[model samples]
Target chain A: MAFINYSAREINCKLVYYGPGLCGKTTNLKCIYERTANDAKGKMISLATETERTLFFDFLPLALGEIRGFKTRFHLYTVPGQVFYDASRKLILKGVDGVVFVADSQEERFEANIESIENLRDNLTEQGFDIAQLPWVIQYNKRDLPNAMPLEELREALNPTGKIPEFEAEASNGKGVFETLKALAKLVLAELKKGGK
Target chain B: MSLTPQLVLLEEDQRQILDVAERLVRDANAKAVYLVDKNGQLVAEAGELKGIDTTSLASLVAGNIAASGGLAKLIGEEEFPTHFHQGERDNVHITLVAQRIILAVIFDDRSSLGLVRLRVKKAGNKLSELFDAIFKRAESELGDNVESPFAEISEEDIDNLFSD
Candidate 1:
């Protein structure tokens, strides 16, 4: 849920980056954290198991400048994408304002991508949020890989609606990372203007 | 089963709870006090917070509470209301408030856990009342269709954020 502190003149929104295991969900956030200026970003916390996979979630607090004299802060979180971590995934979507589905562009991971998308929809539904109505976007990541699927094919399968914005990203090199984030942030703010019902 | 209510912390509400927090710190001699929403947003804080990263702390605290709540359900318990972590020099006491917020107190050798917990219990009740009143007001005012300050924002304004 969005938290607006009138006293502090700040607007806080939550954005989640969700995808299958090893699909660059964490990498996307790391890219943003590395590129953001020091003053604009807070400490990025990753609660993971000893082996370093995200155990619960990764949290990065960002100050996205301000609008109309009120500071805008976006808390970016990424759920552990491994299949067995479904329980943790559901918990992370508690009050998400927006979501970026980071689909692995590799051809072999196609089914895993579809399954994760289905998982996302189900989790959001369980939390009382309709996937179609929520502010959502898709990022076909790992675009630089040799076995990456065609953009059109991926879109036809994942974003059949064609209504939601999509981006092609090679997150390790920071390609299309900011564009995806900027587009999602814009939609989230627009929802806030509509009272975010 | 329902839409999450929008959270609005008004100036008056902030002041009221901040006073309670400040008093809790003074009375308990704690290192810091943080009021965090259950969803991991930092609502307010008081006392010495120099080197601590309250942002990450808030997020981790929420995660802890959520995981603990899950464990409670697995065991057929409703919820676990309080959690305490005793470090060598510092200790943390986290108590759920108003079912939507968490009060986390950090203290050290300067104070005893008994004293901190006592002060926290008294102040937590006061804060819960203040927050309940504020949440009710925010809901009512929202139902009245109050104009949001963001309604007038232009696309250019949002775009400007990424310009740098």
Candidate 2:
């Protein structure tokens, strides 16, 4: 549900970073906040608990370089990752224009990723967004971990549908982070173009 | 009907906001800057952007924040005061100004943490007053009914919005 004011030529889209706990969502945001040029993005806000767990949600607003004379901007959010925070996560997904499913690359976190993906689908349905048609990308994170799960196995369970783009990421060192975001941003803008307004 | 504040209505105030935000941008080295009322109207924006419908987009972003805030309230959490998005290559920061409107900045690889915070702190009060005056006028026009804005929505309009 977007609130569009035609008086100004700016279009704001909401993109949420969603996935299992500790799958590098906040890390991905931190990377973007750090890497974006001083002129293309904005402030990066994080409302995390003192212990570093996301207290509620992580929000970042990106100012994409203008397109076709219109300024394209996106606000990115990340829901709390812990299971008990399901309610909080749903709230963050309310008006999301796109989603990035960050899957923990460790074998132990495989079930978490699957459960999270299911939760994402159910939640999107509740929010009136067609998940199948949504602009979504998958990030297989923690690639640098010594005992990580195989990419094929991770993809089979997380993205077996073969629709969304997927990327490998080592968020700590900033690998594959921008690629995932750029892909999703492109998809989001593309969707808006077809739909107009 | 009361005479609304004349200095801060829509485009007139927007020009002022852009000028002020540009200063904040230069002082802070912020990549992008925008102002939104509490209900999420795009007051002004200055930066390099393409492929965005700013008017609707700013309103929607603010709406996203407000909805998310309501959702947080329902779940019994404190208002999620500030939100930031960290990407691999870029970062966005939003500051709640005077607890009225939002002053947002999108900084890329060049901005330092200290600079962004300092500029936002400096520009916060000015932005707050600018938004408050504008929101007050909007409220007056939509009075006599809290949901009046949507009362005018035709069935076709609703269907079009809900359509895929």
Candidate 3:
């Protein structure tokens, strides 16, 4: 859900990064936190286990400048991608305004990618949100890997509808990170514009 | 097309919420009080906020509530309406108001949990009424012919935000 505070003249939206375990969901958030300017971003909080895997979620509050005089702030979150953390994932999606599914591109991880998407669908339904109607995008991450599957193959398998926006990213180096964010933010803003229409 | 209700806080309603929060802070003898949306957005806050990071606190509080609520369902309860965390120097009392927002009170050794809880019950009732009115206004406004502030936004405007 988006929060529009006319008193503060700010628009706040929540966006979640989701995928299978070790699919670079947290990497995507870390890259954004490192690259954003200090004044444009708030402290990034990560609740991770001792080994650095996300235990609950990673949160980054980013100010993406102003639109129509209201400061647009995006709260970026990443679900624990590990399958057993399904409950945690549902909690994070409670008031989500948008979703970015970070699919691992390695050929060996194709099955995991499919399972994660199915899981995403089921979880969204459980939360009373229809995945197709939400402003969501897909990111083919780890594109630099030697075992990375072809983009076309991944798309055919994952994005059968060929409607949602997709980006190829190597999140560790920040490639396509901002592009994917910009696209999702745009879609969210467009949805907000269509209020009650 | 968004199925979820968007939380829109107008100027007038914001002031009312802050007034209640300020009163709660004084009555409970607490260090600070905060009204946060279930989505982790800080709605209004009062008292000593100088050293506090309200943004991070709001997000963490919402996460805590969410996790706790999930636990409640696991044990066959509808929800856990109240949560308290005590520390050596400071303590917190969290209550779910109207099932849509969180009212949190942070206190120190100066105040007791009993006092905070008593005051929070009254404050929560007032807040619930205010929020109920706010939601009604939002629904009516949506039904009216008022145009959205974002109606004038263009693709170029969105692109300009990322131009830097």
The most accurate candidate by TM-score is 3
Query: Can you tell me the CAPRI class of model 1?
Result: medium
Residue-by-residue lDDT tens digits, candidate 2, A28-104: 99998998777766666666899999977777777774444345567788889999888778767765778999999
Candidate 3 residue-wise lDDT, A2-80, digit = tens: 8988889999999999999999998889899999999999989999999999999999999999988999999999999
Let me know the DockQ for model 3.
Answer: 0.66
Cα-based lDDT for every prediction: 0.90, 0.72, 0.90
TM-score of chain B of each: 0.91, 0.66, 0.93
- TM-score list, all predictions: 0.96, 0.60, 0.97
B133-154 per-residue lDDT for model 2 (tens digits): 6557555542343332223434
Candidate achieving higher lDDT, 1 or 2: 1
Model 2 DockQ class? incorrect
Put down candidate 3 lDDT per residue, B109-149, tens digits, no spaces: 88999999999999999999999887766667644554566
Ten residues in a row with the worst lDDT in model 2 chain A? A1-10
**Interface C-alpha RMSD, model 3:** 1.8
Please provide TM-scores computed only on chain A for all of the candidate models, following their numbering: 0.97, 0.95, 0.98
Better of 1 and 2 by DockQ: 1
lDDT of 1 by residue, A1-197 (tens): 88898899999999999999999988999999999999999999988799988899999999999898889999999999999999889888988999999999999999999999999999999889999889989999999999999999999999997999999999999999999999999999988776633
